[model samples]
Target: MVPRNRSVRRTKAALQSALVDLLLEQKNLQSVTVQAICDRANISRSTFYLHFENKDEVLSSYLLQMIGRVHDALRAWTGSDDTRWTVYFAHIAHIAPILGSLSLDGGPHAILSRYERQFAVIMQDLVMPGRVPTNDTAVGYAAHYLSGGLLALTWWWVEEDRCGTPAQEMSRRYHALCSGQLCP
Candidate 1:
C-alpha cells in the first residue's frame, strides 16, 4: 500500500535518498549495507523494515517512482505522436545517474526490462480507438517489439555517458531507427 501519512512518506524518501548517497559514494550497490542506510537516513532499523525488505527494495522503490513519473509524462504529452520518445527521455534525465552507478552489472538491464513492460502498457493505453490492434496477439507482439527497440535506445543513451546526446537526439534516433509501426 502507498503511504498516506506525510511522516511515512518522509521516512521512505529519506531512506531512498540515503541509498542514493551511498551508491554515489561506494560506486557499487553491493557495498552498501542496511545499517549504513539506517544511519544515513537517521531512521530506525524497525522503521526501515516496515517500509522495505532490503537495500534493493529501497532502490526498486526509488526507480519505480522515477519510472512512474516518466509514464505520467508520456501519458500527458500533447504534442505530435512522433515526439513521444522525447517526452519519455526527458524524464530519464532524473534516472540516468542511478542507472550509471548500477550499469556495471545487469542492474540496468533489469530496470530497462521494467521500462519495456511499462512502456508497452502506456502505449496500449494511449492508442486511439480507431487504431486498435486487430488481435490481442498482434498487440502483444508489437508491444514487445517496439518496447524492445525503445529499451535498446534507452540502454544506449544511459551507457553513452547518461545521455551524452540530448533527449531530442535520442528521440530523433528512435523515430529514424523505426517508424510507422502501429505501436509507434
Candidate 2:
C-alpha cells in the first residue's frame, strides 16, 4: 500500500471549499475560472494542477465525495433483501441536504441518467452479492425504466412547491410495485 500524504490532502480540501464558496455566489459554474479558484484557495497554479486536472475535475471530485458517503451508507445495509429498498431510501433521506444542494452543469435529465446507472449497479450488487447479472439488454431496460420513474418523482419533488402529495403518491406507487402490484 502507498503511504498517505496529509499536506496534499489539505490543499485539495482547501481548493474544494473555495470552489463551493465561489459557486454559491456565482450561481453558474461556467462563470468561475481556474485562476479564480487558485486565487481564492491561496494555492499556486502548479499546486492546483497537481491535485486536479481542471474545474470539472475539482467539482466532480467534490460531488463524488458526497456520493461516496451515500455509497458507504448503502453498503452498510448488508442485510436481508426485504430491507434493501428501505435502507436505500433511508440513506437518500440522510443525504438529502447535499443532494438537493448540488447544482450541476447538465440538465436534470442528464444528471438522472447518471444517477440511475450508478444506482442500478449498486442495486444489482445488493440484490445479487457476488453474481452481478451480465444480461446487457435486461439491465439496460431495467435501468432505463427505473431511472425514468425515479427521476420523474425526484424532479417533481425538487421543482414543485408541493411535496406531501407527490411523496405520498410515490410511496404508494413504490410499495405497490415492490409488492407485485402495478398501478396506473
Candidate 3:
C-alpha cells in the first residue's frame, strides 16, 4: 500500500518515473536495475528502499496506477455505449505515447501473449456483455481474445497515425462492429 505522507508519495513517484525513463532508454526490463533507477531518479538506495523493495516493485506500482487511471475513466462515463467508448478511446489515446514507445527492443513481447492474460482481469471488468469467467471457459477465451486485439490495435492506431482523432475513429469502428459491419 502507498503511504499517505506527501514525502513518501514523492519518493515513490520518483522511483516510478525513473523506472519508466530507464525502460524507455534501454527498451527492455532486463536492462533496468535498482541502481540505475536510483541514479536516474537521483534518490539514494536508502530512500528508494524506504518506499519500494526493488525495481520490479516500482514497475508494478506504476502499471497498477496506469490501470487505475483507465478504471477511473470508465467510472467517469455512463451513457450510451458509443458515448462511453468515445470517452474511453479519448482517454486511452492520451496514453498512446507510452504504449507506442513500448516496442520493447525485440524482447519481452508487447502485450501479445505476455500481457494478454494479465490484462484480462481489467478487460473482463469492461464492456463485455456479461460477467466473464476467469477460468478456462469459452467466455474467458472470448474476453482475452478481444482484449488482445484491442491492445494490438491501440498500439497500431497510435504508432501508425491511423487517424487524427482517435476517439472519433475508434468509436466509429466500435459502432460498426456492434452493427456487424466489420469492414467499416
Candidate 4:
C-alpha cells in the first residue's frame, strides 16, 4: 500500500511538472492535449486517466497546491513584522508564466473562486476575530470585492512589464489600497 501511494505521488508530480513545462512553452493552454502531457511525463494515457480526469483537472490540482502554499504563508504571518505579503508576491512573480497561460485560457475562474472562498474564511477568522458581522451579506460582499480586486491587481502585475518593480513595492501598494489610501 505504501509503494502504491508513493507511485501515485510520483506520477502526479511528473504530470504536474509536465504541465508546467508545457504551459511555459505554449501560448494557449487550450491547445495542450492529454497525449502531449503523457508524452512529456513519459507516462501512458491510461496512467494519466488513473490520476486525473483531464488536463484541466491537472491544472486545477496544480493551482490548489500553489494556493495551499500561499495559505500556509498567510498562517505563518505574525503582526506587522511579517513579510508574508512580499513573499507571496515573489512567489506569484516566480509562477507568472504558469499564471500567464491560465490567463490566456480565459483566466482561471474556478481557481479564483476557490481563492475567494479561502480568503473570505481567512478574513473572517483573522481580521474579524471575536466579532461577527451582523450583516452577513455585507461581509460576503466585502470579501468578494477584496478578493476580486486583489486578483485583478495580481493579473495586471503579471501581464505588464513594470520595469523592475520589486515584489516589496508591489505588496506595499496593495497594502496601501487595502488601507483605503487612494494614491500609493
Candidate 5:
C-alpha cells in the first residue's frame, strides 16, 4: 500500500511538472493537449486519463495545491508582526513561473472570475478568524474587494519588467496599504 501511494504521488508530480513545462514553453494553455502532456511526462494515455480528466483539470489541481501551501503558511504565521507580508511575497516569488503563465492571455482574469467567490470565502476566513462578521454581506464584499486588489497587485508585480523590487519591499508596500499608510 505504501509503495502504491508513492507511485501515485510520483505519477501525479510527473504530470504536474510536465504541464508546467509545457505551459512555460507555449505560454498558452489552450494549445496544450492531453497527448502532448502525456508525451512530455512519458506516461501512457491510459495512465493520464486514469489520473486527470483533461489539461484544465490538471492546471486547476496544481493551482489548488499551490493555494493550499499558501494557506498552510498563513496559518502557521505567529504574532501580529507585519513580516507576514514578507512570507506571502516570498511565496509568490517562489511560484513566478506559475504566476507568469497564468497572467498571460487573460488567464488571470478568467481565473479570478471563476474562483472569485471561493477565494472570497477563503480570504474572509483568513482575515477574520474565530468570530463571524456581524453582516455577512458586508464581510463578503470586503473579502471580494481585498482579494481583487491583491490579485491585481500581484499580476502587476509579476508582469512589470522595470520593477526589480525585492520581495521585502513589496511586502512593506503591501503592509502599508493594509494599514492605510499607502493609498491604493
Candidate 6:
C-alpha cells in the first residue's frame, strides 16, 4: 500500500532519491544495499525497513513510477494515431536512465511482467479492441506475444543502444516502421 501522510511520503521520496543517486554512481543495481541506502538518506535502517522490504522493492517501486508516467502519456494521447510510436519512444527515452538501471537480471521478472501486462492491456484497449480474436486463448496469446515483443524491443533499445542513432532519429524510424500498422 502507498504510504499515507506528508512525513511518510517525504521519507519514501528520500529513499527513492537516495536509491537513484546510488544507482547513478554504481552503474549497476545489484551493488545497492539497504543499509547503504538508509545511511545515504540519513534515515535509520528501521525507517527504510518501514517503507520497503528490500532493494528489489525499491527498484520495482521506482520503475513503476516511470512506467506509470509513460502509461499516462499513452492513455492521454490526442495526436494523430500515426504519431503513437513517436509518442511512446519519446516517453520511454525520457525515462530510460532510471528505469533501465532497474532492468538487471537480479531484478524480479514478475515485477517487469506485471508492468508489461498493464501496458499490454492498455494496448489491447487502444489498438486491438473488438479486433481481438474471438477465442479467449488466442487473445491472451496475442497480448502476451505482443507485450513480450514490445518489452524486448524497449529493453534492447535502452540497454543495447541497438539503433546507434539519436533518440529523435530512432523515434522517426520507429514511426516509419509502424506506419503500415498504424494506418491499416
* lDDT by residue (tens digit), candidate 1, 4-54: 688889999999999999888887787889999999999999999999999
**Global local distance difference test of model 1:** 0.77
Candidate 5 residue runs with Cα over 4 Å from true position: 1-5, 133-135
Instruction: Kindly list the per-residue Cα lDDT of model 6 for residues 19-123, writing each as its tens digit.
Output: 988887776677888888898899999999898999778777877777677667766777756555566677667666655666664443455676877766766
Model 5 C-alpha lDDT versus the unseen true structure: 0.75
Q: CA shift at 85, candidate 3, in angstroms?
A: 2.8
Query: What's the ranking of the predictions by lDDT, best on top?
Result: 1, 4, 5, 6, 3, 2
TM-score of each: 0.84, 0.64, 0.69, 0.85, 0.83, 0.76
Model 4, runs deviating above 4 Å: 79-83, 109-111, 129-138
Whole-model lDDT values for every prediction? 0.77, 0.63, 0.68, 0.77, 0.75, 0.70
- Residue pairs with backbone overlap in model 5: none
Q: Give the TM-score comparing model 2 with the true structure, all chains together.
A: 0.64
RMSD of each: 3.6, 4.5, 3.9, 2.7, 2.7, 4.2
Compared with the true structure, what per-residue lDDT tens digits does model 4 show for residues 79-129?
462244676688788888788778778765555766677766655554555
Compared with the true structure, the alpha-carbon lDDT of candidate 2 equals 0.63
TM-score of 4: 0.85
lDDT of 5 at 8: 90
Cα lDDT tens digits, model 3, 20-122, are 8877677667777899999998999998988888775786678678767766676566766655567647866765544445554442244445556655665
Highest-TM-score candidate: 4
Q: Model 2: how far is 177 from its true place, Å? A: 5.3
**Which runs of model 1 end up more than 4 angstroms from their true locations?**
1-4, 127-130, 133-135, 180-184
Winner of 1 and 6 under lDDT: 1
lDDT of candidate 2 at residue 55, scale 0 to 100:
82
Clashing pairs in 6: none
How far residue 10's Cα lies from its native spot in candidate 3, in Å, is 3.4
Model 3 lowest lDDT segment of ten: 104-113
